[model samples]
Target: MIELNVAIKDKYYENSETAVLSQLDFKVNSGEFLAIIGPSGCGKTTLLNMISGLESCVGQHISYSSNSSGNRFKKNDLASDCSKSEYLENEQANRIGYIFQQPRLMPWLTVRENIELVLDPTQFNKIEGLLAEVGLAQKGDYFPSQLSGGMQRRVSIARAFAINPQLLLLDEPFNSLDAPTAGRLRKLLLDLCREKKTTVVFVTHDLQEAIYLADRIIFLSDSPCTIIHESIINFPKPRTESGIAELEFQAKLTRQFPLLLAGKID
Candidate 1:
């Protein structure tokens, strides 16, 4: 399980500070797929960064708990940690895998090489299998430049799963794809998540995407983002658009989207 109570601030002007997110508290149960949706610039990416240890927040209190052990850390713990290796080791950070908005692949490396770079040497033998899992078995030797945008994103997904992370953090990774492409990728993601039993925190602006993928949906307010509304998605797994389209609960949630954006909900 992951628990977070965090606040974030940024310098908007020379002497002024703006609250990007405030008092956002939520918990993601083990093996649950949680989706966060909010207006643009509402610190969605910032939240992911904090969780991934990529960025720090001013008033952060987060913890990670598993069957074996648990650790609690405050914002100060991150600042005082001197080495990346030490911090990762202490926080069990190696169990985290993040997919950013862009593919972020290296131009010089082939697809297989890029994925292999992050995998443990002991797991090198699984590289071929992982590539095939993402439908890139034939393209492993191809460089990023040779693939289409969607294919590159597939490579990114394969790279992330290569580590077999316990927790996956995705930051609008499909925002740029067309609707059909995005839908296909979402199914691919769902299949992998089910197979791995990994906990996921997916950030996206598309309500339909959230409805289709998440076990629960969290709606956030604008800047100084807070959870204004949340709903449990009871749809059965291996979901499809046609299957959910006829559900009244899905319709109710769809109607609530406007109110969520208007911050009219209590």
Candidate 2:
């Protein structure tokens, strides 16, 4: 089943003559991990902002649907200005989870409190399990400042999954960390997604990261971004970050579009 269908005819910055994204379209399947990778300013973030309703798709040729069963972001509903906090409410039971570039945890709150903040009262009970799942069970009482960057990121992952969201959006959530830390977190994310049966739409500029994580990847062009390349990772699950198969696949991609993987648009 298709979990998300996004077709944004075009997006532009106010007072700008050039379009940031044009004729962009993509769909994510239920329980599948989809990654979008492109150069630095290819409207990757803007595309996510539109999907999460942080950016208005008003007066544009954008059509987004969360799944017919949930009917989220219906074509006519594109005008709605829904903020991230506004989505934490149980009222929007569609449960589309999102992990921003930063951990975005409140400093004053403890790790547990940070997770509890986004969850409904009924889900507060999941905090302990989630904390353990993210390897932060003992640090639940620790503040965000007390935790390492990777641990803090784990909290963000836990918070998003706490909602048991059917669709999760991540915007370069691991780009800043060291290789080992990011690798561990990536493995954690993979485990959680599988256990929870979550469908993910991950955005990144890292070619290997996308290759290591996604079932399929969509590469975008530069400004006026649109799909430039599509590749499906056929290696079975239980794959390593730089496994032989992954490296081989990555090599093939690099050979085919050397410029594209280097964040130079094809």
Candidate 3:
């Protein structure tokens, strides 16, 4: 099982102290998808940064281990090692993969080349196979500018998975696409991640997206955020559009939305 533990002590902006995130704690196991949502400026990204080790924070620890024993509350003494730290640190070279809000592909590179960019020289064939897995085999020769937004995002997804990273971090990966495309991509991603046994930490505001993809939902409060509520996605797999709403997953999340947004109705 892949496990993640995040604890934030304190962080400041400039001379003034700002507790963007404080005392945050959560764990995710292998093949498990976790979603985090909150209002803007609520430090949701800040929390992700700490977990990804992009920014340093006080009083927090981020640790990873394959066994469940490695995920417990006990602090990992090995976190201090430079190599281990680099591996766990924010978006390590190939061990941890990130899919940002935008596709961010290089305009000059074709889809195949873009995916192969991160791979080792000997691994180009692996990249070809991954593009096929993501249903982009036919578009391999197309550049980012030549493809639709959804297709570009698909390439981004393919690149993230090509190297076979242990942990995947997605920051609103499906934000701008049309509903149908986003839904399709979501299912494809879930299936692929499951097959790869990769632990995913997805950040999104869409409740349905969270319900359909995550094993659990962690909701954060407004700025200076901490976990406000958490719900386990107990619904059976092979989720569907109509059935997902019928299962009360949406309603359950709606009931918590107020608290999640710090009591704001909007």
Candidate 3 ranges with C-alpha deviation above 4 Å: 14-16, 68-94, 244-247, 256-266
Kindly list the per-residue Cα lDDT of model 1 for residues 1-266, writing each as its tens digit.
Answer: 33333333331222547766677778787788999988888888988888777775323555565543444332224324245565666465437889989999998999989998987788889989988888888998999999998999999999899988778999999999987888888899999999998889999987777888999988988877888898888758877765645356667765766467544464
Candidate 2 lDDT by residue in tens digits, 75-181 = 32333344435434422645678999999999999999998898778878879988999999899999999999999999999999998887789999998999999
Could you tally the backbone clashes for each prediction?
0, 0, 3
Q: After superposition, how far is residue 25 of candidate 2 from its true place, in Å?
A: 1.1
> How well does each candidate superpose onto the true structure, as a TM-score?
0.86, 0.88, 0.86
Q: Identify the superior model by TM-score, candidate 2 or candidate 3.
A: 2
Candidate 3 lDDT, 178-201, residue by residue in tens? 999998899889888888889899
Arranged by lDDT, best first: 2, 1, 3
Best by lDDT: 2
Span of 10 residues, lowest total lDDT, candidate 3? 73-82
Q: What C-alpha lDDT values do all the predictions have?
A: 0.77, 0.82, 0.76
